[model samples]
Target: MSPYLKLLFYLSGISFAVSFEIDYSNPDVVEYDSNSQIEKTEKVDLRVYYCSFCGGCVYFHTKQLDPTLKKIGSYIDLKNYPYGLTTRYKKHGKIYFDCAHGPAECHGNKLHACAIDILKNTTQSEFYNSCMMNSTWGGEGSSDKDAINCGKLMRIDSKPIIECANSERGDAIMEYYGIETDKVTNPKNKHMPLILLNGKEFNRAKDLMKTICQTLTKPPPECKSYF
Candidate 1:
């Protein structure tokens, strides 16, 4: 080939290589918002306290864990939460621990779509506005839908006292009632929310319901006691 022709071919090859590298490094076809003012300025570390199996919970946890530390501006460090999304005990599958990756992980892309929308520009008030919390027995289907709808409706109502006091799942029943948290103080026991008050004359569930009722202009009628 002639000198000019050879030079043209060489430059074409170089151009192709550069273009390929650029595409490979940044695979996302759509570009994110480029405005620096609205972009997160710094990364902040957040210790997540909820189950990793729930996408909504994980979404909040990730957003709170500012990504700027890695120069990425608000991202999560999966390596940190070893007991992530799938650490439930073998004997008692109802309880789940924590984990970082995999489809089973709480933050799997499927469940967090709505949450992601809220996270982008919605505030805490907005988030709560879209939730619905119910307290009942023998409900069909899963809590995932309830969590989603409750999030959409922004209402949280725990189980009645009777359910809380008598349910076979003691910790779950208490959590639903907002009266007590499972004790994790003992090393032998898995991590669970701490129960603040003893289940005596001071009914934590009733107090929480009262607080909720007071907060809204129109709250639910007097809370029904389980006992």
Candidate 2:
């Protein structure tokens, strides 16, 4: 097993099992509008699955895309899913997740999910960027307070997100993401961030923009400028 998966097993103290199965035939994808309002004649779907506390994920996927997003935003509909790199366990007859970066990261994931629920697409993007800016990989980077702080920085009311983070809804979303991660076949891969463009996995973070540009059937003006 990979070090990450080993860590998971160590934390959970349970053998890996397919606890449940989901309909992988249809994956959840969310479409977002660009920062610009320019109507595009052609568009492609871009999906990113990420763990907030993964340093590599934050550095390569979140921080690196801000500039590229400005150019390709209109040509691509971006959807980001927060995948928690955590293990599930039963404690006192209650199930709990042990996040790699601790409870703060888990809380941050819930915050992001709640933001998606209450904020507009553009706002969601902004909120994600802000939260990521506060994140650290492989450790307890951003705390629950930091998540709320980021929301406030974006002028988003943090109450709803905080409430959601503390509710059963938050637990369900995290569990759902855990299931999604399991769908990936790589035995060594136990963490985030994973990217998929139109149902195809894009493994390398450095090649993300190039891959997206190449995947576009009807190349936008931005594609020409990108390459």
Candidate 3:
């Protein structure tokens, strides 16, 4: 078992059956407009709370994370919450969202939500997400087609994602993400990409692999270089 996983098992004193249910209306998520920024595991349980249109998120994924995937990816289990600094309110049996980046960003968030839920696999969805997000770095606007195109590139069926994105289900999913993020203390994550490792906020500006190694209760061989 991975050391991180062992730590998880030790701390919980139970099986590692973590749930991914989307939980509420609002969270203390930082929103990036031209805007903000923000990774994985099969071993380290990692969660990223981010928004689709955040430039910081895009740059982090495209520049920092993409190249690092091969080094430390095997030891991680990753998940993404695509709603950031977004709020929702229910009225007359319907939920409405107000996103910082406008309607297009809301749409982008829905696409990501649908992809993560519909694909049903964290790695696959992350790849799909990475592709779509990386596109924006090249000055691509109108993110829908690019995101969908990324899905297709992975040979993932985009139909379900598209359907979910345009429907109420997508909104509900976004709402749930908002709820999950709400559990995080507001104002703590003052910048884009609020990352949690082992359910605690991860604060660091070091190399990704090294940071994980340092955080582990028992460092693995792969982490030797950092030490």
Cα lDDT, all candidates: 0.27, 0.57, 0.64
Q: Summarize candidate 1's per-residue lDDT along 1-227 as a digit string, tens digits.
A: 65334323433334422111111112131133222345542212222223334444333322222111112212211112212223333244553323344434322221222332223422221222112111111122113543443332333222221232233343342232221122223354234211122221112223332332343343323322311
**Candidate that would win on lDDT:** 3
Reference-based lDDT, residue 130, model 1 = 19
Model 1: residue 81 alpha-carbon error in angstroms = 7.4
**After superposing candidate 1, which stretches have Cα over 4 Å from the reference?**
1-43, 52-85, 88-142, 151-227
Q: Global CA lDDT of candidate 3, please? A: 0.64
For residue 191, what is the lDDT in candidate 3?
A: 58
By summed lDDT, the worst window of 10 consecutive residues in model 2 runs over 18-27
Q: What is the lDDT for 14 in model 1?
A: 48
At residue 93, candidate 3 shows an lDDT of: 90
Best by TM-score: 3
Candidate 2 global TM-score: 0.69
